[model samples]
Target: MPYKPIESYGVIGDMHSVALVGMDGSIDWCCLPHFDSPSIFAAILDDEKGGHFQIVATHEASFKQMYLPDTNVLLTRFLGAEGVGEVCDFMPIHRDKHGNRNGIHQIVRIVRAVRGSIHFRLSCRPAMDFARREHEVVLLPEGAVFDSEGQDVILLSPVPLKEDGKGGVTAEFVVEAGSCVTFALRHADDWTARNDLLSMAIDGEEARSRTVQFWRDWLSKSKYEGRWREMVNRSALVLKLLTFEPTGAIVAAPTTSLPEEIGGVRNWDYRYVWIRDAAFTLYAFLRLGFTEEATQFMEWLRARVSEHDGPSGPLQLMYGIDGRHELPEIDLSHLDGYRGSHPVRVGNLARTQLQLDIYGELIDAVYIYDRHAKRISYDFWCDLRRMVYWVIDNWEREDEGVWEVRNGRRQFVYSKVQCWVALDRALRIADSRSFPIDRPRVIAARDKIYETIMALGYDKERQTFVQVFGENALDASNLIMPLMRFIAADDPRMLGTLDETLKQLVSDSLVYRYELEKGSGLGDGLTGKEGTFSICTFWLVEALARAGRHRQARFIFEKMLTYANHLGLYSEQIGHSGEALGNFPQAFTHLGLVSAAFYLNRVVGKE
Candidate 1:
């Protein structure tokens, strides 16, 4: 079987973990129980060895899938010569009476015929521990059990499932109008359940309805009355779905080892939390009235501050789910790479890099919380004071920028701007709340960062801010300067930077992070090409909108939206042939989409 293109996959998750459902109705990638846990079905990574669970119409059938309106319930319709059937796929949102949440592990797949008649073929193969551990199957009277040395899988299905080779289960049934069937799988480490099959089906249906209701109710609170209502809503939901409910930490993307450059070595595990991703994620949530998510993430951020000491040499760029500092990067050699993308890596090495932008990201989140939440305890302000002081001390240092380039550290233009942002936001906090802090020190830090960035990071000949001090190359990160108000969008230097970026980084209406081949030096170590950075493209759209180029911005914004795969999703980058590459459905990309759409609709509305 040939590999499915990246865009052909849709996602379904139970808050704790997610599964990538292919257009052909096979679950090629799924991590059980937890987002970082071993995948039960990983054919997306190793098509031949990695096991998969597929349920599809056996005949010459065509499928069309979409989410139920205003809900996360995914419905895929299959039409063949004989009949038409619909697969209702959803994970019930487990919530308390007060409307809070917990880890969602169970996925309920129910199939029913809407018209004629369609035959469904079901294959359930639980490849434990990345398909290395094999299991022994036991067929019980009610449910089937697959038990391995350290893992277990229980089949809670309406019909009896026949055992196949290597602990697999297979079932085939025909469903006519008004006929329905259910299949549910739950994972645990040595466990059993006395589940009544009929009641489980009933519970699944109720949970599905409530999950949709929960999303619809939460979405109703959105403060955005913008023009791209559909796009914004979908982006908001995707962001919500990616969040880890137990820890309140959001992963960069759901899937790991999705190649940035196909058959290349740009793969990195993104299941861990990055302070940078979460910081911007907070703002996106706040905009959509997702106060619960925002509050949880802010608390998660505060926990990080409380645990760590001052500065810590430019805080680790990312952390484990429980906020652990040490993330030992490793490569899974056994599993063949996604489309022969060699050396499938797990855990990110960039976590150890000194990305100075994190300082600005943390300070920005603190400022955002202060602005929106309005009440900060004295203790919280004291922590803020320490953060502010640290920024003043560390603003001038050279470190890796946001891209986590492994090359030698340079005075990146975007890092300097963010250092400026750190002080700027700190000043806002001190003034608005009248908190006791060193005012002159902040002013000094702000002015120094501002002056140095302009003097060092700008190219006078090019009339724009360059990627690094004394360089002529433009970076997509420069687009954020205007958005951050480090420079006005109308400022001649800022306009020139935008123009230079368009001339250099953009291709086919998309933007690259930088000249990977050139800027990525030999001593930097890693080698590979990648797709256009989705966030950079959105940043360009935002910069254009701010520069009073609304028409051009809207055109570009709409064009980028079209790049989303079948289910209105985006990854970190778009490959050369427009495949969704990098980590699947990255948060940075979706967050950028929301911000860009909101601005485009807003500015265009004024006209």
Candidate 2:
């Protein structure tokens, strides 16, 4: 089989984990049990050695794929000279009446013929632990089981099958109109537990209907009745899927090591939650009236802060879905990386980096939630106050900025601005709620940050704010100044900064996070170039809309929407040729989409 393009895939999840389903009817990337679990099928990363499960047409067929309306249920249709067939793929949502999710992790696929007789082939190849562990296949009366040391993958099918002689299973069959076959890939700890989950026969039709209803009901809670409904809803659905429902921690993306530059060494694992990303995610959710999600995330954030014993402060940059602190980075040398992007990495090492901007993001999210969702508990407020003091004490120090640049830290202007944001929001919260605190100290610190930034961070000669202090290079992140209310959007300084950024960091409306020109020393400690950042492009859209450039913002916003994949999904970046680079269905990109769409609609609607 040939390799599929990164964007030629759709994703489905049970809110605990996700699987990447290709247009050619194959599951190329799926982490078992949880979002951070080791891959069981990873052909997307290593097509030759990584295992996969495929239900493909026997003969050449043209394909069309889409998600069922308002739901995550995916349908891929195949049309050939012989017949027409469709594959319906979804993960069943087993929720109780109380609106809590049950622990059912499975991917169900139903193959059915819609026209004349059609022939199909089914193949199941399980590579446990990223193909590092050996497994034994045990044939069962109902299906087959691939059992490793601690994990068991059960493949239950209602068709006859034969061993492929390579420790896998394969089946070939033909179906006429109105005929259908069902397959379920269930993951469990052992064979006993696997059998228990399979004991109850799942009515495929009933499960599909219920899953669709579950998504529709959840989406109905959205209060966004604005323009671009389809695109906005699709972005919302992707965000929902990326969220780890158990802990309310949203992973940045499901798959890891998808290169930002093809064959470049820039790939890093994104299957963990970052404080900045999660906070922005909460802000987006709140904008759409999804207060329940916002409140849940606030609870999660409070727990992370209260349980902190580390000297690094209240939180790390990122954490595992279950709030595990230690995420050691490792390389999978055995399996070749995606497109041979060498040294496939797992577990991000950036988690331990001191990213001071996280404090600002965290505090800002709490303030937004308090006003838009609900009141913060007194205990939570006390914890936030301590976090504020930490910021006040350490605001002058330099750390990794929002981009998580691997190069040695400098006095990033964005970081200092966020520290100002932290103190500013804290003061507002205190005054509005009359919370007891050191108001005088907070006010003085906030003013000090503003003064320092204006004095050192701004470059008078360039008439713009630079990427860092004492430099002339521009960055798209500085565009957040007006959005954060650090400066007025139409202020002369902000307008100059915006124009300089568009000139230096933008190419045809697509924005780069920063310039990597030689001798600029701002390549982020990586080799090779990268695609235009989708999030930064959307940031530009938001900045333009907020600056009263309504016509220009609408033009760029509409053009950017055309870059999304056929299913209205976005990866982290877009190559020069308009191909999606980096991890697929990135949460940050989608959050940007949601936010830009919301603000653009409001601004354009008023006109």
Among these predicted structures, which one has the highest TM-score? Answer: 2
Q: How high is the CA lDDT of each candidate model?
A: 0.80, 0.88
Weakest 10 consecutive residues of candidate 2 by summed lDDT: 518-527
Residue 449 deviation, candidate 1, in Å? 1.0
Q: After superposition, how far is residue 67 of candidate 1 from its true place, in Å?
A: 0.6
The model with the greatest lDDT is 2
What is the Cα-based lDDT of residue 159 in candidate 2? 85
Candidate 2: residue 292 Cα off by (Å): 1.3
After superposition, which runs of candidate 1 have C-alpha atoms over 4 Å from their true positions?
96-104, 192-202, 310-314, 518-525, 605-607
In TM-score terms, candidate 2 sits at 0.98
What C-alpha RMSD separates each model from the true structure? 2.2, 1.3
Worst 10 residues of 1 by lDDT: 192-201
Residue-level lDDT tens digits of model 2 in 423-528: 9999888888899889889989999999999999888988988888777778788888887889999998988988888888888899999877723677587778
Q: Model 1 compared with the native: what TM-score?
A: 0.95
Q: How do the residues 1-607 of candidate 1 rate in per-residue lDDT, one tens digit apiece?
A: 4578878877777668888887777888888778887778888889877777788887788888888887778887888887888788877787898867743266778888887777889888777777778888777755577677766766677777898775688888888887878777766564433233313443666777887897788778888778788888888888888888877988888888888888888788999898888888888898777888888887777777765563345357798877778777788899888899877777788877777788787787778887886466677777767877877887677777887767668778888888888888888888888988888888988998898887888888878787777666677888988877788998998888888888888998899877654443422346767789999999999999999988889888989988998778888999888888888878999999888877787789553
* lDDT of residue 108 for candidate 1: 79
